[model samples]
Target: MSSAPLSPVALFWRCCLWLILLLALPAQAQFTLGQRATDQAATPHVQARLVVQAPDGIAAGQPLTLGLLLTHQPQWHTYWKNAGDSGLPTELDWDVPPGLEAGEIAWPVPQQIRVGDLLNYGYEGQILLPVPMTVGPDFTPDADGTVRIGLHARWLVCRVECIPEDVQLQVQLPVAQSHGAFAAAFADAQARAPAVSSALTGQFEVAPDGQHVTLQVQGLPAPAQGQELAFYPEAADTFRHAAVLGRDWQQRWDGAVWHATLPLSDMRGATPAALEVVLGLPVAGSSVAEQPPAAAWRIAAPVQGQWQAAQLAEISPALAAALAANQANQTNPTTTAPPASGGSNARSGSWLMALAGGLIGGLLLNLMPCVFPVLAIKLLGFARHGSDMRAQRLGGLAYTLGTVVSFAALGALLLALRAAGEQLGWGFQLQNPMVIVALAVLFTVLGLNLAGVFEFGQMLPSGIASLHLRHPVADAFLSGVLAVAVASPCTAPFMGASLGFAVALPAAQALAIFAALGLGMALPYLLLSWAPGLLRWLPRPGPWMATFRCAMAFPMLATVVWLTWVLGQQTGVDGVAALLALLLALSALIWALTLQGRTRWLLGAVLAALLGWLLPTLAPYLRELPPQEASAASSAPGTALWQPWSPEQQTQLLAEGRPVFVDYTAAWCVTCQFNKRTTLSDPAVLQAFTLRGVQLLRADWTRQDPRITAALEQLGRSGVPVYVLLAPGKAPVVLTELIRPDDVLQALAGI
Candidate 1:
């Protein structure tokens, strides 16, 4: 018997399920800031106090202890010494009496707080941080001077959401000859504070190689197994919290001095003058409630001076120790570093490096998927002209020059936009729908042409072919231009670093880097031109060339299909239809250009031009369509297996004691698609996840998303596809940029 149609209730449930799957960003809004805690007469969720040790009234020309006390409301919490990804660090800015200088705050060890998927390093309940102050012998107590102190404090209070708070505190102590009750509390807080003499303190010195920064510290303690440490940079742009760490512990008479290999925060900026590194010894049965006593050390190091290949080894421990000590000595009783006035010339070196980077990057571009089709054509052209060895080589040289010149033009454009106050990046062009659509149409047309839909050689009117490639030099220049355009999507490995650096360099330097990239792209071709014998190795003119050319069309077609999907994502389904119409118009125009009769061809040209101009103009009007849902491959229930992408859903899954796996992917990335088809969607892997009760989440990166970009940045990655797995009550384990099923399983082993 046939089954009856679904009832209204069933239909409604299906629609709701679909809606929940489609709206993932609301679930991804894990980072929030607002007033989350209530302040009441019963007890405040947060409280601040300024404590100082002095006579009953306070005294001039005598030593004094300065301190701050922070208390949080029940169940709510405030930030710790090193607030993780989102919250602001607890900071205190103090103004004190003349002739009385305060020392740096002696911070106690802080607990790590977890809110959803993110981990913040801070505190939950009441905690006190103290500082010591001294009065100069020149001051007199009979003057009846009042020691006025002001503190500017900033902290973050969080419940489910986080809010940054700033407060101003004022306290006046009269110069007297006796002591107060609060002095004892200050003394007690001081004992809990980590000693300045024990923690690893140092200045970060950038290695000449630019790949590493060396930290030099004085009085560093010896390193043992399981030493937990964190580096806090005074400058926000100096060092990211996430990066591969390399630690070298040097044992000295006083303690072990740690020379950490910190990746520079921005290769475009100078290394920080000094970084406060707090290291803790793991204690038995210690939890967040019981933080291990932290060892405090300070190292003062200079960020300037050009150290070449010769200077790396000559760096002295004494110099590092002195720099650390100097930075520590100059600190105010406040823990915050003074605001930096301006950026230094560390960017100059970056530009020079960018130029070199571009050259290397360009050289690697020849092998990139985007440019491979163009390379085949160029290679075939060389083989056709092999008899004229010199000419063959000349042709290759011309192509190489073309690539370089075009890259220069692109670089200049990027630099110009930046100068105009635009926040553009390396792949910014790809973010524009118009650009993507245009490229899609162009690639589709090129694919059809290669497949023998029309012949460009026969279609051009008088002066057309000449305009396209009249002179060998012009042909070379045009080839270079086309080469760079084709190579846009396939970012060569080293080129990623080079391009990232170029984005932050000055205009001139950035352009130079691009020029270098062009040079790299054309280097091999130029070499073939300079020595024409290379073409002799290639097959002579034959039908195989035609076959190879036809085969190359497949890659171009694939590129077009990928771009079409990308266009769909950016402007939606209507935009995809518009792109298809544009492609059809392009094909008609190409045919018209090749037509024997002038009248017929003229009409095709006009129609083609009109379509090109009109379709894009109409694209913006198209409403975005929801993603097409495919039927499940297995009978597993959605609730028991795959959970649709949503930030709230993720939080819910974490709360349910389920391990969550997130895949941030894009349609444009061939690598991403391959992983989805071959690994992620594999039945074995799916079964493993199902058996383990894993909650799978997918974040589509086919479109430009600011939130995803920021998330990627937090992970120390600028691009995707990224796979992250978060187990209950632990830090998330990030898989490598490349995917491996075994690696994934290994990372999920214990969980």
Candidate 2:
């Protein structure tokens, strides 16, 4: 028997023979769905099929995709959600089991079709429209292993002339398991479908002038400067889409956020509660390696107070007819300015100096490793459009605004939280477990994005773009946010005193100081923009930029490492493991996106299952704070020279007349980690500490510690990486937020 083992060729023939046998007996021997479960219609210009793509059928509680495959003849076309000046969106009438739920049709990006003087939006040749269907968890499969789903689909197929078509389509599937028959169709549909709007918030307001509406947006990826920013409304008569679609509107972008005024049509009709819009950055001839971004958003808005006189509440048909007849008599109200927030406070000279210091401190922070990576990317962004003065100055200003707003918001939050009685400081946000996880994820995504693993802005499937997001200023503002988020861990020289003073002052004063710091941080870029000649020093935009971007990703990756370590410190090894798993899932999804055809969908579903399985079991950890690090920090990490910092340990060391050097640090503190790796741990510096008999101790402040808090308060500081040097009988020497190698040596030598 061993000698008679089947050859590879023989095995292949045997498998083929079995498949042939299986196919031969399939008529009645194999299971099949009811006759009404599938349908197809054909015409000279098109062939439409309503097929249930599930080959293996659906399992209980599982969701599957149903596809409308429309194969149009050459030069024939189909309409999109908005058919522009003509045509209608495809419609499907669902008739499924009582327990099943069907979702709306997912639209692919449509091409702008123009015929003579009229413009239309639609697709040419073949296209697929997929609708999502789900089964209930409590559903029980029929004994026949079959489930029935039906659709009454209708559309107008066009080629010079339009022919309306209607057909009944149905699919019969086994309820035991999911199959792969429509895998390619589903993939194609999803590849072209619009993605859900991200977490950014936007608001639209009716201006006092009956002709205008202002829209403001916040959050989302920043568009490249001078990029095309636009919004396409889904509703036909809501705004003056015809008139205001082009030169009639005025838009100002403070980074990725927007402030836009749209002129209204002669008749606005009744204002709806909300408007659904497609926001995007239009692709340009000079696009980088990445595609432009487009998102679909439902913006909820209310009419501003100034427009009360013009807003209409439609009455009965008879009254509406009368009002419509008199519509010509209506007059447009005068325009008014927007309202302001917070009262005016006169600026004091002393306040100004403190603010200037904050600005300088923030600017200096750019040199810190914590902020360097993101800033590098931002600098590159600025340099890319250095030739355009309008873009350069606007980008710079928007970035400054982003920084100041973030800082002010942080300061406001801190003051509010402090006013509520809980003990908190400048870096208190890091103490929260959720914040830690969020920052880690953000850092990881940014690194991956920079490395070209995926595009941040082009989140939608092909064909979606934000007309408003194209203003490159969004990137500048977002850069400001990134800078502040990362730089929190490190306190630069001159920053500590300024911050300490600011935190102790009134809310307005504190916010002012924070603003000043942001302005200072943003000043260098502003100066470069103001002086266009400096832009000449930058390397021209080309392939090298991509390489440079990839290189910068590593530093961001390094930052993520530190953040992960910080998370471990705050949440323990188990929490770190959970977070890492989430990251792994995210990475898998990212990779899945790069694939095409059926493989992309099949793999995505599997990976999504894995992530879904993991989230419920580990989600609680996001809210779970770590146990105290008091005992954990006591153990020396790789080196015995440093000891855990504590009041008792410090008192004992000082009483023994042993000169002490304390490193007040945190895992999240980038400056602390930077100094530890570069300056403090230098061979000469370690040698100097050893020779001085200085007992070096580390005080970890990753978690909230009353003792550490007291230590910082006593020193008149409110942040970490505060190095203190003490001699047997001398006062403690408070080194600057940032220290030089010589500063350390001199402090040790004198103390």
What is the clash count of model 2? 22
| TM-score, per-candidate, Cα-based | 0.46, 0.49
lDDT of each candidate versus the true structure: 0.56, 0.64
Query: How big is the positional error of residue 311 in model 2, measured in Å on the Cα after superposition?
Result: 75
Best candidate (score: TM-score): 2
Per-residue CA lDDT of candidate 1, range 1-751, in tens?
A: 2122221112222323323432222122111111112111111246777666666445545567767677787666776555654566677777765666778776666655556555455666677777777777655533555556777666667776444455556666667645455766676566555556534345656667765566655554555333545444434434444442223322222245445666553322533344455544444446433453444333345664443232222324433433232222121111122223323543444455556656776787687666776677677667656587666666766777777777888778766875786544445567666567656655665676667665443543435433433355555556566677767555554454455555555677667778888888889888887774665678877778677767767888887877877677655667778667766765676666655667767887697667546543554322232331211111122323454354556665766788898876655544455567766766777877878888887765554444555444433333445677766665565554446678677766757
**Highest-lDDT candidate:** 2
lDDT of 2 at 28: 18
Lowest lDDT 10-residue stretch of candidate 2: 328-337
Clashes counted in candidate 1 amount to 39
User: Residue 618's C-alpha lDDT in candidate 2?
Assistant: 62
Q: Show model 2 residue runs off by greater than 4 Å.
A: 1-353, 456-458, 461-464, 467-471, 619-639, 648-659, 678-695, 727-729, 740-751
